[model samples]
Each structure stands twice: as structure tokens, then as C-alpha cells.
Target: MRRYPEIGKFTLKVYYEKDPEVRADIQKSIAKYADFKQNVKQLNFDSSQFVPGIDIEMMYNDMYWASEGYIWEKIQDEKYDVDMMERDFLKMVDFWKSIYLRKEGEHDEGN
Candidate 1:
């Protein structure tokens, strides 16, 4: 699992290319799934910072079918669904692992 240095307050950052068509499509899709505004460029879910909590951040890219994204959380205890935390941790690990492996001539293994 991957861990980032704690930043005091929980914050999620999503980055995407600036594209109008792609941005519009993402807005429409999110609106269809939930009550979201068309102009909403960013979304934040505020939840308890205690252990076993999740925070989601989403971003859209004009040229990519899957939106680029990230999630950040502070895990404290195992009383909650720590599996979710582990999953997120693995995702973060996989991201950097892939990059490093690629640069080091190691097999990406279908990554």
C-alpha cells in the first residue's frame, strides 16, 4: 500500500486537461448519476476524518475516456472498513510502481 505524508487537513487534488467538449460530457454524465450542476468543475465529499472514512475527488479530461482522478484519506483504526483504505493504498502504490517499473525496464505485467 502507498502512503503520502499527512497534510493536517484532508485535501484531494484532481488535474485534467482544459477541454470544453470533454468537460461538458463529464458534467452531463455526473448530472445523470447524481444531482450535480453543469458548471460544477470540482466536487468534494466531506466526511469524518477519523479512521475508516473515505473522501472522493474526481476530474475529467477532454481526450480521455476515463476521467483522471484521485482520493485521499486519513486511516486511523481497523474498526471500520479498512479494506477500502487498503484498496486506495494499493491504487496509489500501483500508480507509482508502474511508473518506476516502466522506467527501470521491468515488466509492467499488464499494468
Candidate 2:
């Protein structure tokens, strides 16, 4: 029989109004977490695997207009479906930010 080592996992869900201001606020919170994580490493808990696994999903707010203008242009040129484009783009932004933080931690560990 093969055995697998237990792995740590954390799951978090943050739901808030879909306004740009709200999203901006969430972004700020994530930035703060990034700063905290950096500080922790500086104090030397410096394990190569110290990067925390983070996942966030934002509920789509119909009231918020993500793309104001160029809607048609986006649909025609970029083939972005008007209905899903904005929300998808924002989710992608959040995903990338998490990736950046993870890589930053990895860099701090010299791994």
C-alpha cells in the first residue's frame, strides 16, 4: 500500500457588493496580506513552501457595469461576449494577483 503525506489546506470565501469601490477595497485587503506575508518571511519562517494557498471568488453584481464603453468593439474585435467579459476580466485580475504573491514568496525563499 502506498501512503500520501497529509497536506495543509485553507479555504476562504469573501463576498461583497460588486461595485468597483468594493472591489478596490478587496484588492487593498489582499495587498495588506501580501505585506504581512513579506514581513513574516523577513522574520525568518523562511520555508520554501511558506506560500499560502489562496483562492477567491467574487459574486457577479448585475448592478455594476464593468465595461462602460467599447462594448461593441470588444465583442467584434476581441470576440468578448458582453455578458461575461467584465466579470471574467476582474476574476482574472484577482487570480493573477494571487499568483504574483505566491511567486513573491517563492522568490523570498530563494526557491
The candidate that achieves the highest lDDT relative to the unseen native structure:
2
Query: What are the models' TM-scores?
Result: 0.23, 0.22
Q: Rate residue 32 of model 1 by lDDT.
A: 45
Task: Quote the lDDT for 100 in model 2.
Answer: 32
| Model 1 misplacement above 4 A | 1-72, 75-80, 103-111
**Model 2 C-alpha lDDT per residue in residues 51-90, reported as the tens digit of each score:** 4543211111111233323343453443344346557667
Please report, in order, the local distance difference test score of every candidate based on alpha carbons. Answer: 0.36, 0.40
List pairs with backbone clashes in candidate 2. none
Residue pairs that clash (backbone atoms under 3 angstroms), model 1: none
